[model samples]
Target chain A: MQADYVNPIFKAANDVFNSMLQLEVSRGDLETNDNLVSTKEANISIGVTGDLNGSILFSFPEDMVLDIVEGMSGMEMKEIDTFVTSAMGELANIICGNALTTLNENNYNCDIVPPQVLIGKGQTVAMSTEQVLTINLETDIGEFDLNISIS
Target chain B: MIWKERYKIGVEEVDRQHKELFNRLNDFLQVVRSEEDMEKKAAEIEKTLNFMGEYVVVHFDSEEEIQREYNYPDYEEHRQTHERFKQEIMEFKQEFEADKCNEELVMEFSGKLLTWLIHHVAGADQKIGEYVDNN
Candidate 1:
């Protein structure tokens, strides 16, 4: 059940990144690093719940975040403020939304929350981690850490 | 995941290939994004890069061939899109070798490709699917 739920989401994320961003990405191991920390300029997170629940967080250094947003919107995203964060959040949302559809096909009825953009230092969200799986993605643009845990 | 019934765009051969293309992309991405060693992941990335460059071109060509067969109204527009992709792929190949640190370019490219394919299939190419359905 966990395999079915997470694999598709990971695949869809790769596909979206491949097609939408044109950067080839590979998954990282399900590392158990709860105290995971990043000094990257921006991190956008979205929540998943019911039957399967956790969070997908996309982290990027300042320039990388702007580059991603600029490409998606076809406009220059100069700063790591509200508008840029919202745009980045939407990309995460789209990936999760597609992943949910993939999950539904495999018999897991799950839904997702609106994506949230976290700003500044000390923005930490905890997960059950007891049975969590992290779909870490290493890409040319940056890295996306997808942590999935069943509640 | 094999191409299910839902993604069909009506044209027989092209539809078959489209499903195959999606499956290949999925497989390629899975390998690329695998939580393995960096060397292993980079190996897969290099391998899949070839597939995307060569295979995607072939796929796009075949798709265009089908469009031509049916006299697709947006043929010129579609062709231009393909041309742009081809050019960008070449540029990426060069940049990839020259600049290892510039992964941002790669990420941006992937995002654009993902969004473009969905809209192209669901919006532009779907017209052909509609035509085949109607005819």
Candidate 2:
């Protein structure tokens, strides 16, 4: 993620969580996530369009995904499955949509494709094994990571 | 969720339709998410989707008339959003009618409907209020 992408996406997360979920979240410094794999992470990838054509990957730990689903839906997301994955993907989509709106006002006309849940622990994003940008978003129950690459 | 007074723009006709829209969508969501029998749920779910298809066009037409009355600066983009969503919902309902047993698509449509309503109200429609205030 570039600084622009990182900051705006983080700002979007903050605004959305605060307004929609009424949850205050904090983020740590941007770190590298070269070894991150979706097979091990409960993440959703949403594609972007217009000025930005890429995929924003939100990598969450299984426990954190459950925590988020529980927090958002007021129900128990006992395990990571289609229901849980779809819910989380919708969250990511909301965040991305909010971010796109902000970016649009900043002269970045962007839209997003629907969100897709990457299941299992073997599929990879096939990015260069470099120090990709990531932020550890700490919430009350758990934390999540936001990873992005513009293709 | 029901449309609140704060959601109104002081426009009689448009505001009334928006309220009806929120009520219909909220009712649809309630029934769709009900913890009820799957066999018995199909009728009500199908009904809501069919209603949404019609209500959206009527609601958008009424709101757009108000938008034109006020010369809404963002009318084009706003109408575009409505158009795209209407098309998507139509597609979703068409798919549901084709395969009534596809639980996955129904759930996906439900989730999208929930999120879309909240954002459209809290974010997009809120701007109409801003326009109303300024003009």
Candidate 3:
């Protein structure tokens, strides 16, 4: 994928974290993975269509997900249940929608569909793209992975 | 679900509506999360849901009018997102009508609404204020 596609997503995540969650996001080393897998407690996949066609997978560890949810809603959540997963899905949805808006400004004409959320530790997700660029994001509360796969 | 000061978008009317949304949603969520049985709370939940459904439409319309008055460049896009959420609310109403207003649906709806409203107000709606500030 082009840096044009990837940069906006990272910027969106950083901006959303800063403004909404009051958390600062730092980028970790970039990595590439062949298949999309969920190694965390909360995982979300949002599909990109229009000019860009693929999906973005976000994986958040259990502790981090709880903290993030707490920060967003001020609710004390203990488990990765329906409410938690839905919140995660909306979080990813906002990040992807914000990124696509940036792309639209550059005339990329891209759009993101609603997110599909999964909770668990081990599951392989089917994606439309072959080479996935995984961006590890660190927040004070915890860490999560943003896997970008677009053609 | 507390509404933080950071969620305000600087526009008085819009911010007021957003805060009202936050307040109502917080109350609705509180009732939903209570220890009361689902059947006992169904009437209250349905009433709050209906009120929220109507309030959201009014809020969106008012906000959109402000966007137009400011000639906000992203008015179309912002309106599109509003339409999407309105559709979701409509679906929720349908589910209620279909008598599927169970704990699962209520939980999912409340969760999605909490995050969606915050992000929309703080992120997308902020851009409109930023646009006005810069221009």
Candidate 4:
């Protein structure tokens, strides 16, 4: 994907984290990884259709996931259960939806499907020739990765 | 308690409704997370779910009216977002009626509700505020 396409996703992530979770986020340089294996425990995959036909994968470590849920709900969560996973999926959905809005404003005209949450570690995602633009985001709660693979 | 002033979208009516929505969700979250028996928690969930079903429609209607008055460019898209959430809640209510004591479904619903509210109010609804300020 073009470098310009990545900006909207980054901006959306930053805005959501800052506004929703009240967390400031700093993103690292965007790098491409051909073989994308998620080392994090929680993965939320959001599918994009219309002008762009691919998926955006949000990978969060176990602690980061727990921290986010606790931050949003003001409760202590010790494990990645259905409640935690669903919250992560919805967060990913909101971020993707906002990014799509930005893309539409730029005349991209795309829509996002419901997010699917996968809970596990060391899961390898097969991209099948799609270039994955991975970016590491640092936050006070923890660190997470945004893997964008959209054409 | 989850309702923060930062979620205000600069519109009085919509902001009030948003706060109410957050309060209701926060109430539900509190009950769900409490150390209560399943029956007690289920009863509270049912009450909140019913209130959410009716109040959400009212809130969305008011917000949409404001969007139309401002000639908000994204009115249709924003309404669709509201509609999708309404549909999901409706489905959840149906499942809840069929199995009133399903703690798992209630937990999932609570989690999704909290996340969706925070993001929509702080992220999507903020754009409406920006548009009004700009125009």
Candidate 5:
């Protein structure tokens, strides 16, 4: 993926974290992964279509997922249940949606499908292509990964 | 309690509606997460859903009107998002009416609502505030 494409995703993640979650996020070095795998317990995959075609995967650790839900709802959650998973999926959806807007401003008209959540360990996602860009996002609650593969 | 000062978009009317939405959603979530049995919660759930369904439409309309008045460039896109959310809520209402005692559905709905409200106000709607400030 081009730096142009990746920057929007980073900006979106930073903006969403700061505004919605009220948390500061600092990004680590970007790296490439051979295949898409759930490095964390909760994974949300969002499909992008139109100007760009492929999916973005957001992998969140179990503790981070619970922390985000707790932060958003002010209620304690101990497990990765349906409610937790749904909220995680929406978080990915929001990030992708904002990225699409940024892409549009740059003349890349695109739209995103609703987010799909996968929960479990050792689950793998079949990439549409060979390489995926991965970024580690460190937030006050915890850390999560953003895997991007779009042509 | 879900309403936060940080979520304000700087547009007075829109910010007011957002707070109302958060208040309504907070009430709905409390009942959904409560330990009360579904039978006992059904009436309150139905009432909250009704208020949410109607109030969302009102809020979206008022917010969209502000966008139009300011000649917001992304008005159509913003309106489309509101339309999609309204459809989802309508579907949920229909499902709830068909099965009034489904605690699982209520739980799912509450989770989705909480996430959607936060992102919409803080992410998408904030752009509108930026535009207003710049203009």
Candidate 6:
């Protein structure tokens, strides 16, 4: 996808992490994804419609998933259970919603469907054949990747 | 979960309702997560669920009223999100009333509620504050 479509997602991720999770995110390397499988333990996939027609995949490591749930709930989260996975999915949902809002400002006018949370590494997710751009993001808790395959 | 000062959207009534929503949800979560027997917690859980489902509607109405008052640019989009969440709450309430509510469903509901509130307040709701300030 063009930077015009991709940058909003990155910015929204950083903003949500900062404001909601009380953490700073440092952007890491960017690469292209040839495989449609997630390497991280928790994969949150959200569909986009309207101006964008593909899906957004947010893959988070197990530790980061636990960290995020614990941070938000103020309770100790030891494992990636339903509670943890659901929270992670909602996080992805919020990020995508905000990104679409930004895209609307640019006249892209997109909307996101409810997020689907997939647990376990190497999970295959449905995505478009369009070029998939993966951007690595680092936080004090852990690292994750944002995969954008929207056309 | 505790409501942080940062979650405020600069609108007094809306922020108050948000804090109340957090407090109520935190209580409901505590009941859901308690070590007590499931049968014993059933009545309390149902009561809280009813309160939450109704309170959310009232709060959304008030928030939407404010948005209309300020001519919030994203009023329709924002209201649509609220409608979706209200429908979710209704589904959960129906499940609970239908005797299908279990630990898994309760856990899932709590998790979604927690994350949804935080993000909506800190992200979407903040836009309302910004719009009012700018105008």
DockQ (Cα-based) for each candidate = 0.03, 0.23, 0.64, 0.65, 0.63, 0.62
Model 2 stretches with alpha carbons more than 4 Å out: A22-25, A38-42, A48-54, A60-84, A98-113, A119-123, A139-142, B1-19, B35-37
Candidate number with greatest TM-score: 3
The CAPRI category of model 1 is incorrect
Error of 2 at B104 (Å): 0.9
Lowest lDDT 10-residue stretch of candidate 6 chain B? B95-104
Instruction: State TM-scores per candidate.
Output: 0.52, 0.78, 0.87, 0.85, 0.86, 0.85
Per-residue lDDT of A139 in model 2: 75
Q: Cα lDDT for residue A29, model 2?
A: 60
Model 3's alpha-carbon lDDT is 0.84
Predicted structure with the largest DockQ when compared to the true one: 4
Error of 6 at B36 (Å): 3.9
User: For residue A147, what is the lDDT in candidate 3?
Assistant: 83
lDDT of 3 at A54: 88
Give residue B77's error in model 2 in angstroms. Answer: 0.5
> Interface RMSD (Å), each candidate?
9.8, 3.4, 1.4, 1.3, 1.3, 1.3
DockQ of 1: 0.03
How high is the TM-score of chain A in each model?
0.82, 0.83, 0.95, 0.92, 0.94, 0.95
Identify the runs in model 6 with alpha carbons over 4 angstroms from their true place. Answer: A49-51, A104-111, B65-80, B130-135
lDDT of each residue in A1-151, candidate 4, tens digit only: 4655678888888888888888888986678888666758899888888887777888899988998898787789989988898888888887888888899998898999898877776666656345788899889988889887777
TM-score of 1: 0.52
lDDT of 2 by residue, B48-79 (tens): 87786688899888888878888999999999
**lDDT tens string, model 2, A49-118?**
7876766778778987777555544455567865567767777898998888788887888889888788
* Residue-level lDDT tens digits of model 6 in A68-136: 887777777878888888878888888888888899999997888898888777877777764678889
Q: For candidate 1, lDDT tens digit of each residue in B17-126?
A: 77666666555545533446644465566677777678778888998887787787878988997898789778877876675444444444454454445545544566
Better of 1 and 4 by DockQ: 4
Give lDDT: candidate 1, residue A117: 71
State candidate 3's DockQ: 0.64
